[model samples]
Target: MNLLLARGANVSDQDGSGTPALHRATHARHKAMVSFLPENAANVEEKDEDSCTALTIAVKGKFEAGIKLLLSKGCPVNFSYKPRVSNTVSCT
Candidate 1:
């Protein structure tokens, strides 16, 4: 995966379920994989079938390291839910 990323793999590409590499990494708790992705992987902000971003999933899945990485990479911490609740407030 690191080699592929180095060769310019599309880190932002979504899977059939609209899950981005970041999302999968977070779900799998693959901290190294999460770190190996482009530093901007969190910034892609791809939404899954449930309209959840990697940051969102990371928080929900208790992937604290991934969440921290995402935030450090500038992923929007203030992302809001469709129902209008604030993600930052609720996720914490």
Candidate 2:
């Protein structure tokens, strides 16, 4: 990924489902990659097709290191997954 970044890969580019590198890293439980992406400019606030943020995925997966890393990078602790509902989930 370092090489990819050096080669100008977009850190924030999203897949078809809008899942970014940060989200994928968190989902995979790769704490180091999770840390690396944010440092490289991946947005922790980005959401996938399911309206899932990296922090949300981290919390759901119980990935402690990932959750801390995202929160430290300033990812929002509260966001609404369901439209017009509420900030139903709290990553913090």
Candidate 3:
């Protein structure tokens, strides 16, 4: 990843589903990658096709560390998985 970054890779690039590298790393539970991506300017709020943010993915995946890391990096805590849906899930 460092090499790719050094070569000018876009950390914010998204996949076919509009999932950014940060979202993938969090979903895959790759702690190192998760920690690395955001520091390099990966959009913490980038959502997938389902409108699931990195924080939402971390919560669904039950990744405590990932959740904390994302929160520490300024991920909005009040963000809902789907707007207008009263069913909100908690990461804590």
Best of the candidates, lDDT = 3
lDDT of 2: 0.80
Order of candidate numbers by TM-score, starting with the best: 3, 2, 1
Q: Clashes in model 3: which pairs?
A: none
lDDT of model 3 at residue 54?
89
lDDT of 3 by residue, 1-92 (tens): 89999998999988886778888899899989888898998888776776678889888778999999999888876765442356544332
Between prediction 1 and prediction 2, the one with superior lDDT is: 2
Candidate 2 vs candidate 3: the lDDT winner is 3
TM-score computed on alpha carbons, candidate 2:
0.79
Model 2 C-alpha lDDT per residue in residues 1-92, reported as the tens digit of each score: 89998898998988776778788888899988888888987887787776778988887778999888999999997864333346344332
Candidate 1 residue-wise lDDT, 30-64, digit = tens: 98777766464544456676767777877776788
Model 1: worst 10 consecutive residues (lDDT sum)? 83-92
Indicate the residue-level lDDT of 12 in model 3: 92
Score residue 18 of candidate 2 by CA lDDT. Answer: 71
Can you tell me which runs of candidate 1 are displaced by over 4 Å?
Answer: 6-8, 40-42, 80-92
TM-score of each: 0.69, 0.79, 0.81
Q: Report, for every candidate in turn, its global Cα lDDT versus the true structure.
A: 0.70, 0.80, 0.81
